[model samples]
Target: MKSSIVAITLMALFTKSFDPQPELINKGNSWNKNPVIAHRGAWKKNNLPENSIASLKEAIRLGCYGSEFDVHMTLDSVLVINHDADFYGLHIAQVTYKELLTKKHPNGENIPTLEEYLKEGIKQKKMKLILEIKPSKNDPERDQKLTDRAVAMVKKLKAKEWVDYISFSYDVLKRILVLDPKANVAYLNGDASLEKLKADGFYGADYHYSVYQKGEWFAKAKELNLTINAWTVNSAEDMKWLLKNKVEFITTNEPELAFETIRAVQSGN
Candidate 1:
């Protein structure tokens, strides 16, 4: 009886579950501010596939602080998560949302609608979204439309509290600001001067670690009180560097690895 009670306690402790949501911590928004964000939703091993509901749910189960995914509008103007353009050379914008739902990836994940993703994310409240607006080369007007639609959906779901917008294009970022001035916008390619970006009105920026350049820009970003979240950070040394330098966030393929590494290093320091 004693052994059985111990086993039950261990199982209960390890199997702690929460609502499957986005699991991302917004900048200075959460108490802990866990930096590691699963890319394309913690994808499966051995090339299973990415940006699918299964992968996202798995990410939440793994206890990642957050996850990043792309959103685009279908021909029928429905929002769905997909990383790339289809064979037709356009992204979700070219296909009907119904077609996307009816189709399956090689790994057999049903393409999920943005609403489905948001619903799951909102349930947990800890899961935050780094929504990438993927505009196709074929569609010139698609960026604006995607931004408008995304902003609308976010507002409709009343999920602005848990979401952040990221993009490489300055124009798209501006559009998001116009659509909802309160929305947090992350500049994906932050190679320019902080003053230049700030003058243009940006909330924060994420850059490749290599582009950091260790120059006046880093100091400038810090001075402006801007939030910086770097990307694809996988190395312990890099996480130590980011934490030491006080970068606000990081999105990594290996969230568990990064989280463990950061906590250990911080504890030691």
Candidate 2:
């Protein structure tokens, strides 16, 4: 009996040691002052598998304002997180989640479902989730279904406040607006006019970094009271320029560099 008691105590101690403690996240409008969004969850520099849960957790640990990730639906309507249409040679749109379960990311994590991803995301309340809803290329019907399911799941999870939906498809973004009139949506296509965005009630513009370079779109977006976010900005020069221009958010593969740049700018160096 004494040996069994000691074994139980050891097991309890081991579990306690391994349990992850939630970090104290900065709250409310904290991201307003120049946020650094980790594109694909701080995966690039860390050599971690992109779009995996590990990547997401790492972003939160790094205190990124947001972690950007892509979501696609399986044949069984399970919303899975991945950047590409295919996973381990199996097409995500054509395969069931059960089939996907047989494969794993390079880091040994199974393709995470959107539900699973969001649950993980919510654990770190300070980090916003930049969810890119990838549209179906040839199937408009499937595209609509994907959008519908994504909206529904996010609503059910009560995670709307933490999520910012972005898409290259104007139609898909419009459908999201229809589903939740208050949903924060950003247009990914860099060509849209600020006036058009303002009139259509879009939350902001998440365009390519270069799109803001040549035009007065940055000034125009600010004029319209629209939030501006630029994507995949990796270079120190680009990062510094964006910071100087006062872009609201910078999505980058090089989050460490981005952070350093922001600190330098803030310190007036």
Candidate 3:
């Protein structure tokens, strides 16, 4: 657990003391600032189709505090969740939402748009967002446009208090800042230092566990005011240790297991 003072100070930085909305303190009710964000919208083990609404709902049912998903724009301008630039075989960016809707999962479920998922999931609010803005090295401009549209929609929906935007591409994150200065931005793929992050104006840092090798960086993130969230953690031992340190978020493929573990610990059972 984070020291009370540290938690208070960190919360104050991201969320003002007078904001009136409750802090998303992950004591037991909500997710930690560094939460367990389900990868690919919490797909069922059987379906294995990432970014499906079915998986998202199943994650919720399992009491996952938050979920993360990819958001790409359709040619006609809809924010849908899919990892690949193309859906199955077709390039999703070139297709309209209606066109993408025509495609079906192996289980016959429909592909979900970001907006649809957000609206559907907002009622729960337990699952905060870690919206990753995917930019291709080959087509950076396309990434920017997709990011801009997603940022605009998020702002229009007034979900600032609920979502954090992250990306490996620095430009994509910068674009989000331009769209919403207060939008929480975390630099994915931890390679830079706190000094470097502050210089770059990044609010947080997220790196893979293999790369998250520095115990010192955790405190460094706290001191530098860069919120820390690690990714794709699935081990019980690692999860326990990180929780002990109060690492803000734990992105994972096994959200159901994570939540169950969190519940077990919280309930003192």
- TM-scores, all candidates, are 0.80, 0.87, 0.79
Sorted by TM-score (best first), the order is 2, 1, 3
Across residues 1-269, which tens digit of lDDT does each residue of candidate 1 receive?
99988866754443232111122234444522456678888874435468777777777776676788888778987888877766134446656776666667777667767888888777665567778887666655877887888889999998887788888777888899898887778788766667766777776777876566466554566678666777878788887777666566777776777767765654454
lDDT tens digits, residues 56-86, model 2?
Answer: 9989888887899999999999999999999
Model 3, runs deviating above 4 Å: 1-34, 45-48, 260-269
Number of the top-ranking candidate, with TM-score as the measure: 2
Model 1 residue 184 CA deviation in Å = 0.4
Candidate 2, pairs of clashing residues: none
> Residue 237 deviation, candidate 1, in Å?
2.6
| lDDT string, candidate 3, 1-269, tens digits | 56987765664553232111233232333543335778877775556678777777776766555677888788887788888888877698778888887788887877777777777766676666668877776787788788888887777776666677888888898888888876777788676776887777777777886665655777776676666677878887677666655667777887767766665544444
- lDDT, model 2, position 255: 88
Per-candidate clashes, comma-separated: 8, 0, 5
Model 2: how far residue 232 lies from native, Å:
1.1
